[model samples]
Target: MFLPTTVEEVERLGWKELDVILVTGDAYVDHPSFGVALIGHYLLSKGYRVGVIAQPDWHSGEDITRLGRPRLFFGISGGNVDSMVANYTASMKKRKTDDYSPGGIGGKRPDRAVIVYSNLVRRFFPKVPIVLGGLEASLRRFAQYDWWSDTLRKSILLDAKADLLVYGMAEKAVLQIAQTLEKTKDITSCHGIPGTVFWTSQRPENGIELPSFEEISQDKSKYAKATALLQFWTDPYRNVLIYQKQDNRYVVQNPPQLPLEQEELDRLYLLDFERRTHPYYARMGTVPALEMIQFSITAVRGCYGMCSFCALTHHQTTHVLSRSIDSIIEEAKMLTKHPDFRGTISDVGGPTANMYNSKCQRRETQGQCKKFCLHPAVCENAKVTHEDYLELLEKVKSVEGVKHLFVSSGIRHDLILMDKDADRIIKKLVDFTPGQLKLAPEHAHPKVLKLMRKPPAELFLEFKRRFESLSKTLSKKRYVIGYFIVAHPGESMHENDYLKKFIQRNLGYHPQQIQIFTPSPGTLSTAMYYTGIDPITGEEVFVERSLKHRNKMKQNVNTNG
Candidate 1:
């Protein structure tokens, strides 16, 4: 069942007051893929009366006030994707449409959406405690560079004036927050929860202090140092309370919440989701994002690939968590019963398709190592395998009503080459993949690839050769397409030219999935973008900040296609 979106619906449910209210920037689609829906259903199962106010108008109190104030607090998210990225393109021009909005409208959500919605809620209920979560709040919890404004910005906790902020996948932290508010009735008292950050006037004892916001704003080197420190302290088992002085007070971030165990992850997926947009928004039009992913299955969460430009490393962490195959098959069976059932299941993988069931004992005993699992080369400790995943694909495909199952998630081609059973895994992937298989080899230059913490260009070329050979042997006319990033830190016109030649000569096509780098908050590449120095090694790197130059590189790469 869908959560009540209006007062009339709330009344229809015969509930006098709601325990928690979630406000978001996207049209509410009650599917597990949507963050608000997953969180709302999780809270509801825990016996909290939850409601959602999605895409509320920031200009007035009408839509914001419809749900009124919750008995506990208001949880704000800028939808699944960050609002700034959703509203603008890499070139900083406004986008034409948003897939998450009803009818795929462009301006349904405002920029800095979490801050805007929090302030709007405060206008009507000044006394109600406001809590912030989702990608915008999670990434912006510290002072970082903003690409759109082209300036350093303070933490969203201070700017939004929110009482607290929850980072990472927040199932555990949010439940604790709800329970604390119910018992104590004071938001400030709800500190010391893992996966939460709050402002405090007093200095916290036994906490590591990051460079002050004032210091980092003025000194680029200091900012780079702080970014490195944060990444180093991300392990939940070994991390301590870390604080940063913003101005008059300190922003204290508790240790990260540990990745949920298998059973916990399995239960979250089995929640009651309608798997469609609510009728309230459906009357407007269909959401294009839901249409693409409604049939897909999220078999895993978190990724070990610490690519410099990707946010999954910071948001989901470097530890991989996967659900049991029995749990996954059960969900696939549920899809067969849906009224919108088609024989095809669009996807059946997670952050990285092949990372499914990949585990290392060192992570449990010692926490994340400074060395990456796949980068440099696959570590000996990195037990990369595909036995369990191959079994999963076979079982899911044999389910009664399913005709085709595609592994649409990103696959780490480098891992496939390292696996002992590479031949069998590649054959299985070919059977499940649609016409084309996509691989993200960001650039061809070795220096740039090193700065991005990706495998050397030679590895990608070797993997492409093997994949093509296997396809030909199987009589499958499938093509391997490459994705590239332009103007990342340590990349320039010379590097872009090198990438163009590599694509034309080796890939034999002007690959279409090209994009200029945007410096979002809390990413290693963004740190390099802001500082012009690689954080890994304290050496200066080149960055293309000029919009004209960035656009020209993209255009040059796409010339022959």
Candidate 2:
């Protein structure tokens, strides 16, 4: 059973033999599809006692420690820490906020709460094994460039003092870790688990070492490609040899599984919820903002959009699999039944909102398409249709108690505007949409859009006009939130100047939430950012996002008044 995060409450629950205690910073609300709720529920079904600590202000070390140290394992993730950092840095410049200052917990510093929690755990129970997981740890799995600090840094595990780092989908590895820990308390005994990186006293002095390049690489070309790719991988430290015990070597492995069938996706969502009605509600107080209605739901995992700058496609393996409509409805029903139910659903979409039910057309023939579609030109044989996604939206909207269903995820404007069914979806959105639609055109410049592998700006403008026309006809107020990227490699000052004018003329000088391009690990843009050259071709390039350039852009906006 899962208990809320309170010592007395946990004791009263009498789940001391609980096989695992999953500690997370994300909320217990399953809507947004953060990993904690799913993993915690999965553990409970396996008969493990579980508890959730949602967004505990890590500043109070006591708050984290007070959860009653259990004979269990901890799971942690900060939603999307890398993106959060990038967003924070960009926001700070515009707001003139000192949040990222040395004294502030902002900037590229490890999440303060996560840092404090780790220190507190070590201080209180030094021997208890601590494993770090989530985007924060995973993307920084190797030494990569840190845009803020402008230097390469080692893996977050080494910096955070975590005993192990679990990268990629942690379902299997987390289960194995819990079962193994329940049987024994030794860290060294866990060296054999797949999808985990660990360090032990008995291991080689440098820790569990990965296999050398020669052993893992089949050819010199592959090694050269990896080495070249590594140069542009940005973090805060230099790359070091980190071994994966599963494959018995240091090389990166293919991501685990990409569930394609609806049943598999449903099983992933049908995880057990063991928390009783009372304690679960009571623990809500411990969370800073625990509104049940503010939960998010991921309709799809993995994005085929394959934006050059996005790490999601690479990390998630770019196979767009969606939760079944019935599964989505079921989860929505559960969210509405919560005592504090609000009429609105916070977010209902994944990497891209409109791409629900999207899949490869060649799935039946190719078994599964492993390679990402990374062309500037849209695929002529695009398999997923707009009709399929509209059906999903209709089903989701029909769920009882769902007053407002919103799409907080990015929209693939290319697909939405190109397809005839997409026109219906947009019209439906204007008529039936709860209120807002967030779309990411990424850039307005043709050359930059080409590099980002995004739809043409003209297409987005046309879609915007059509959406506006629909909104006017329906007598509904609707607006599109545009997303743009700045400081991409090869983006010139002249280009940004033109972009600013374009936003002023088109998006109306409202500061269109521009993001400074930070090269995360394992993206084409990252490769370009690091080497000052494109990885696919040996051509030289200029990487943008210098501190001066960021300041200049901000100044331009401020002065534009």
Identify the runs in model 2 with alpha carbons over 4 angstroms from their true place. 25-32, 53-69, 78-88, 91-120, 182-194, 198-255, 258-261, 267-296, 361-374, 475-477, 518-523, 557-561
lDDT tens per residue, model 1, 1-561: 899999889999899999999999999999999999999999999999999999988899999999877999999999998899999999999998999999998999999999899999888999999999999999988888888898888889999999999999999999999999999999987897899999989988877889999999889999999888888786786668888899888898999998898999999998888899999999999999999899899999888888999888778887888899999999999999999989889998889978888889987556788887887888887775588888999999999999999988999888888877787778878898798888899999999998888887887888778777888999998778888999999989899999988888898877779999888888999999999988878899999999999999999888874
TM-score of predicted structure 2:
0.78
**RMSD list, candidates in order:** 1.2, 6.5
lDDT minimum window of 10 residues, candidate 1: 231-240
Give per-residue lDDT, candidate 2, residue 30.
42
Q: So what's the TM-score on candidate 1? A: 0.98
lDDT of each: 0.90, 0.59
lDDT by residue (tens digit), candidate 2, 146-179: 5556554455655567677676666677777888
Task: Report RMSD for candidate 1.
Answer: 1.2
